[model samples]
Target: MSDTRNAPHVDMLRSPLGRVRGLGSAHRGAVTWWGHMLTSISLVPLTLWFIWSMVGLVGASREEVALWLTRPVPLALMLLLLVATFYHMKHGLETVVEDYVHAAAPKFALLLAIKGISILLGLLCIISVLRLGL
Candidate 1:
């Protein structure tokens, strides 16, 4: 029921790809994606090892568990697990915040909080393990 004679050309509203090439490119997309994939892949083996270790220690007394942790390999692996877990967690939360939170200030604040909390918790966990193991 509307007149089309005076309408603007459809092509006028469409941008040519050449003209818009790098306008909105965030250069870090590939790095972030790679980080996500690597973390997820690393988590599989680390998580499995943690589960297997815990299962093996199910009936162990506190001292037995501590003694097992005191071994160099166990202590190192535990540290690696904690690091990978926290880094993965932080990366995931940052992605969520970047995707969902559009506002600049709030997005930045959320990212800062996520990083701060993740580091704090990771350090606490590492310290706990060290205390128990060493």
Candidate 2:
């Protein structure tokens, strides 16, 4: 039997330095929450404007449509919507890919491909909108 006074004691819950190292501050999750909120709020007005504009054009004549689209303000808004939509989509798809794709190489490749496709599609949409405006 060992003497109790000379025995080493281990506290399972506490370390000698007082706490575990490398465990960072707790607010990291809030960043993602805020990012989602910001993206959502931005999309709301853009989506409403796009839908309203389309509804207003439902029965417009070809020339009238052309004239409306060619205006600088609408054209600018369309461009902004195109960019914001693609950015939002990229963020969402990236999250999905990160969550579901377990393999490193395939995950990275898929993410890169998604980004490429989103950029290309956004550019194409901008060009098409511009051509219509022109």
Candidate 3:
């Protein structure tokens, strides 16, 4: 009984109420993406610096290696590398799990685990670095 040409448009998959209630997409696409990119970009230089520092310490004795870490430059850069790499890894996994894992429960669980483990590992590294400096 309705005129097809004059009918209002409606999204079949998502209801109008859903849109009004803001129950879609989570609006975090750009933030998560940019965080990943920035961390990745930062990691390039940090990783290179770490490798360069390692090369210098390659033939050093245990005490020499410990002395290197006790220095402020190596200590700070190492902590930066730890934090940035962990954050980068966490976000990368989050994007992958979010895209591929469709189930809500599993997706949430995986993200939580990834972030939690990443934080724990990063903290452990930082603590170890600080202990060496102290």
The number of the candidate with the highest lDDT is 1
- The RMSD (Cα, Å) of candidate 3 is 8.9
User: Number of clashes in model 2?
Assistant: 0
- The ten-residue window of minimal lDDT in model 1 covers 21-30
The candidate that wins on TM-score is 3
Q: Report per-prediction Cα RMSD to one decimal.
A: 9.6, 12.0, 8.9
Show model 3 residue runs off by greater than 4 Å.
Answer: 1-26, 59-61
Instruction: Show where candidate 2 strays beyond 4 Å.
Output: 1-37, 59-62
Task: Give model 1 RMSD, 1 decimal.
Answer: 9.6
User: How many clashes (backbone N, Cα, C below 3 Å) per candidate?
Assistant: 0, 0, 0
lDDT of 2 by residue, 24-80 (tens): 243133455457677788889989999999999998998887798799989888888
Each model's TM-score? Answer: 0.72, 0.66, 0.73
Across 1-134, the per-residue lDDT of candidate 3 in tens digits comes to 66788778765544566556645465433456668888989999999998899899888997897799989888888888998898898888887898899999999899899989999988998898888877
